[model samples]
Target: TLAPSAAPAASASPAPSTTASPAPTQATDPAAAAAAPPASVVAQYTALTCAPSDVRRSAASTDKAQDWIAACDRDGTTKYLLMPASVVGTDVKTASAGLQGGGGTTSINTGQWVVNVEFTGSGQGKFTRLTEQTIGKQVAIVLDGVVQSAPQTNERIAGTAQISGSFNQSDAEDLSNVLRYGALPLAFERSQAESISPTLGRDSLHGGLLAGGIGLLLVIAYSFLYYRAMGIVVVASLVVSGGIIYASVVLLGSAIGFTLTLAGIAGLIVSIGVTADSFVVYFERIKDEVQAGRTVRVAADRAWPAARRTMLAADTVSFLAAAVLYVLSIGSVRGFAFTLGLSTLSDVLIMFIFTRPLVALLVRRRLFSVSRFSGLSPKMIGGRAAAVPVATTRARLAKRPTPAGQKRES
Candidate 1:
């Protein structure tokens, strides 16, 4: 019981009411009771509505909300995440396996995300832990903030790791550059895009071919005129070297999508001069030895070391130039540098393999030693030294019998 002005306490005893609602024990007005509930009760009710589990359940009903939650949950701690099956496709396993093995290294440094990856001892342990922790989760290899790979781990990995996707040589090289050097090593930015007409490229190619053909003709003519019979060997060596280079180009084009751009063609054209220079060096050295009174075979042998040194020196300069150009230049200039470097290497190979051997074989023959047709013949080489006479003075005098009287007086 309470005074009239004071609020009545809540009744301990449960009681039935005329209305269907629970009986109100307080002495407050029915309207006032309906208008407000106790603060504690209201707080409890609000908290139930805002529980973490309930919010998640509500979010699960909408696709966008679910995605938001999923993304938010990824803190790089989870080993793997589910991605669209279509994005990963069937080749995912194979590629992922390849990534587990170490691949070869390269020099081109684009610097996107090159990491020094190894499977040796400590590396193996780290990779194994990474694979275990990230199992069935996505580990993204990001380059320049773009996801280069978001590979889902199917199993724990151990030992060496290789990064594999649908990568071209350039892509692999670029990635390797990144892993080896770092993201900003190259510092490349898209400068500008200008449309190049194929018409100009075609015209340049045509002119280049024409010039190459004329140069080839001049070399062939000079070889035949100067080297005579031995010139055939020189021509043959050139043909073989050309065939090898052409086949290599075609194979590289097919296998690696290496394009024969105009600049590349120019490099090949320049290589022709390098190759010719090698031949000239060897030929001149041999002729010099022959002029120094050595037999043809001996001259060929004695001249080789000096000629080889000269050829190597010349090719070294060309190779160095090509390498520098490749390192310094970009775009089409790189193609030119690559081709020039390849040709210089081929020149060295041809000098050692075909040219030297063919000359050695040719000089070994009797006809080559004796005939004027052979450019290496001692008599034919500069006409400087006369051939040694076989007949003796006594034999000549006996044949003449110049005087029986002169003999008797003697």
Candidate 2:
């Protein structure tokens, strides 16, 4: 019985060896095993699961998924994703290539693309149609062969549709700027650039203010030295002009987003010079007339027209130059141009309103006209003939014979 058991065990051992040999043979044929269809592939073929039931449906029948995806890809990876219909709030049509539509020419440029779509009087209809048609379709917005966006329409849009994808804020801003500014009649080109840091700009403003203050002080000192008591008129005029300019700058800053840079400060300082020059011209003209033997009041009146003409001519040239520079330049140069123009305009306004009116008022005062300290007295006019003296009523009475009786009575 034991020998028979041993024979059976020996036969089982050969079976184990046969199984071990097949394992090695299979290990050597790994490439062949890998070439065989995977279990997952076999299962896929044999079993059929339900399709994804969660596909998002668009409100608009034409809203297609493919259009959105294309738009997203075109916009790059960083832009805010937005739907077109939401932005335009109107109906849009799917235009064929080179189709001219009602909105404008559907054109493509190197940096951007245009989608030309025709909108009905009820833009909603066109939007609905576009949304319905583009559903699940890759609708591309092409600009000069570069696709801006290709968004899949998820719903039928009742209004205008927008597809935004990977655009940066700058890109969106630039696009918006183009849309808004392109319709304007004016043309512009960059002519210069000067980058000024905030710190540097502040320092410049400080220095400019210091210089302007010194200049103003010198002007006031000279006015007092030369014009004496009447110099108050010059100071008052300057104050009024300064106030007007300050209010204007503040209001402009609020209204038009105007900024006051260092260059602008320079412009203001220069305007001070212009304002002073106006005063000097008027004063000198008045003095010359007085030296020619005219009364102060007469001289002031006579000098106005000539002074006005001269002021107009000078301001006109300054303003024109500023305008040209503003139109032709960019960046810091623009700041300079803006300041120059503003100063020129303020100069004109001050000359007309504050300076002329104040001077006219001063001339009407007897003290200003007669006092030597007022700088307008005829006696102040060097080498000029003196005013003729007339006898007073008192002097005439004293010379009369009745005056002796009045003296005895006193």
Q: What TM-score does structure 2 among the candidates reach?
A: 0.48
lDDT of each residue in 177-244, candidate 1, tens digit only: 43333332233457998998969878988998888888888988998899888778778988988988
Over 4 Å off, model 2:
1-200, 383-410
The most accurate candidate by TM-score is 2
Task: Point out where model 1 deviates above 4 Å.
Answer: 1-200, 384-410
Model 2 Cα lDDT, one tens digit per residue, 152-214: 445555543343333444654543332233222333568998987869867877898998899
